[model samples]
Target: MKLTPLDAPGYEKVVYAEDAESGLKSIIAVHSTKLGPAAGGCRMFNYPDLETAKIDALRLSKGMTYKNAAASLPLGGGKSVIMADPNTDKSPELMQAFGRFVESFGGMYTTAEDVGISVEDIEEAAKFTSHAAGLNKGAFASGDPSPVTARGVFLSCLAALKHAFGRDQIEGKTVALQGLGHVGMYFAEHLHAAGAQLLVSDIDAHAVAEARQRFSARSVAPDDIYDVEADIFAPCAMGAILNADTIKRLKVKLVCGAANNQLADDAAGDALMERGIVYAPDYVVNGGGIISVSTEILKITDEKWVDRKIEQLAETTDKILTKAKALNASPHKVADQFVEEVLAN
Candidate 1:
């Protein structure tokens, strides 16, 4: 295994890892350490190129800085990416190799599960280094964060619903959800149990079929999700789904989901506000995973602490929406301002 360092202007540290034997190639970016050591997740995908992967690492790491602040976790922000087809390239040796690279950062960087990565895969990574979190087994393990993350997002959606429509109940509400991955699937289950009507879409046909069979969801094509006329639009998939085009096509009154970096650019938030759509900041709404992972980073064994923090995340979401409405500003701007104040303090 070989690790090559790279210069990233806004990041604390960036490295590219390569292990020929294990077929592992990954980039790890540490965005900040203002509050504490950097902690985030490792994402594995078949990115078109290394440049795109690096960009994702940088953006996601910075998003983590905000997410940790929103969750009130005593940690900074960092993220990593493995450039390969997660469905095909994943192997125990490759996971362990990635773990070795994470270990190289000492305590400055801690990893957990993210897109295309699972608790079982993280367990494999944990075998090589102690940096991996979200372990299903162990004294301090927080286990898989999917359910908790889904819970946070569902609560966030409720908060947005209250702010938009004067009601917080999901019962009888129609939600169009994009993506049915780990977090997405759990989110679907939450909405389903709450008696919400679902319109779902995903690149994976099997997952979409499962959601339809299990949740009684109506399936839409991936691109058509934006056009679905629903009360809420939940994007639990990849980032930047709400750019200029899709935001205009959206027919929902509230936008909330677990996807990170939902806005393609800062102006996207303003556009959503102009449309009268209550946009919950992605970093604020999708923070349960980090809150759970922080326990392993801080070695906190209390499960109740995690629950309390998740509840607080919902409160923060509500506050942000309230402040945004009062100021007649985008929630994205208010959310960033809050984090900026925390980091500045």
Candidate 2:
């Protein structure tokens, strides 16, 4: 195993790790510890290059910081990303090596599941260190956070509807949702239960087919999702999907989902505001997962506490939306301000 520390302004620490025997190459970024020890997910992806991976770690870590703050959890923000593809390069050895790297953080960072990462992999990592959360087995184990995250985003959609459309329910509304991963699928269940029509798309045809069968969702080509006219556009896929080009093509009145760093840049948020689309900050809207995982990290075994926090998170979203409307600013900007206020005191 080899570790190389890197410089990252505004971040507490950044390091790249590689294991020759297991072919495990990854980067971990700790963006802040002002609130408490950092915690986030470990994701595996076949990034184009090391630079791309570093940027992702940095952005994702910072996003986690805001996410924790938004959820009012004591944990700070941090994240790790693996360079190898989950389908082809994943192995128990590689996951164990990654666990060793996480152990080197000395409890300053705790981890859970993320894209291309499974509960089994985190369980394997748990064999190496106690810094992993979201485990499937254990007295305080908080399983996969997808359902909680989806629930938060679903609540956020209702909040945005009340703020923007003057209604609190989604019944009979059309939701154009991108990506049908675990979180997306769970969110679709909430929408289906609420009687919201789903217009869904995903790179995974099988997942799309499942949503179609389950919710009678209309399947749209992945690229054409932006053109679907709907009341809400939920991006439960990769980051930066709401960039300049796609933002212009969006016909939805509200945008919310479980994807982190949904905005390509601050300009994208500004653009969405200009276009009259109510933009819910991804970190704030999708924070229910961390709220659940934090319990295991903090050893808080109260499920009712988590339920209360999830409900309060919706209230926070309502306040941010209301504040943004009063200020005529983007909700992301308002959310950043709220996080800064949290960090300041």
Candidate 3:
């Protein structure tokens, strides 16, 4: 594999690891350690190129930093990405080797499941290292965090509705969803239960069919989601979909979802602001997964704290939106300031 020089200035540590024995090749990026030990998820994907995977790792790790800080969790940001398709490359040997690599960080970076990784996969990885989360056994096991993450995004969606449309509800509103993955599917349930009509799209036709059948959702082509006339545009897919071209096609008033690094760059967020769309920062809305994993790390079995933290996402959304309104600035800018303020002190 060709190696690219790490050029991320804001990151605390960037490491590339390879294990020929298990056929493992990965990159781990720790973006910050000011608040506490670095913690994030490990993603596996068949990236087209190594540089794309590296950029994804760097962007995701940085997003996790802001995510943990905004959620007020005493943990920093880190992420690892394995450049292989889980469909073909998943194996005990490969997982254990990755776990050992995580252990090399000596608890400075703890990893959980993300993307192609699963609860069982992380539990397998845990056999080689205590720095793994999302396990299925033990008192701290949290399992898959997709439902909780969707719940948080749901809460943030309502908050965005309240801020943008002056209603503290989703009833009768149309929400266009850009993905039908775990988070997106569950989020669709929340919106459906809240009486919000759904327009859903996904690369997987089966997932789209399931959602459409379950929620009476209207199915649209994956690319046509952006053109759907709706109250909110929820992008639950991968990051950077909200770049210059897509933003120009948006027909919604509120933009919120469970996808991390939703903005192609900071300017994409500013573009939404300039278009008069109420944009919920992706990191703020998608912090539920981290919040759930934190419960395992902190050994807190209390359900109340989890509920409170999820509910606080709405409060945080209101605060950021209000500040943006007051300053007449982009909500993303305001959110960055909020994260910086929390991390600074």
Better structure of 1 and 3 per lDDT: 1
Residue-wise C-alpha lDDT for candidate 2, range 1-345, written one tens digit per residue: 899998899999999999999999999999999999999999899999999999999999999999999899998999999999888999999999999999999998898899999889999989898999999998899999889989988888888898768888799999999999889999999999999999999989999999999999999999999998898999999898888999999998899888999999999999999999998889998999898888899999666988888888888999999999999989999999999999999
How do the residues 1-345 of candidate 1 rate in per-residue lDDT, one tens digit apiece?
Answer: 888888799889999998999999999999999999999999999999889999999999999999998888889999999999988889999999998999999989999999999999999999988888999888888899988999999988888889989989899999999999999999999999999999999999999999999999999999999998999999899998798999999998999999999999999999999999999899998999998888888999776998898888889999999999999999999999999999999
Ranking by lDDT: 1, 2, 3
- TM-scores for all candidates? 0.99, 0.99, 0.96
Q: What is the lDDT of residue 150 in candidate 2?
A: 93
What is the alpha-carbon lDDT for the whole of candidate 3? 0.90
State how far residue 240 of model 3 sits from its true place (Å).
Answer: 0.8
Model 3 clash count equals 0
lDDT value, candidate 2, whole model: 0.92
Off by over 4 Å in 2: none
Q: What is the lDDT of residue 132 in candidate 1?
A: 88
Residue 210 in candidate 1, Cα distance off native in Å: 0.9
Model 2: lDDT of residue 210: 99
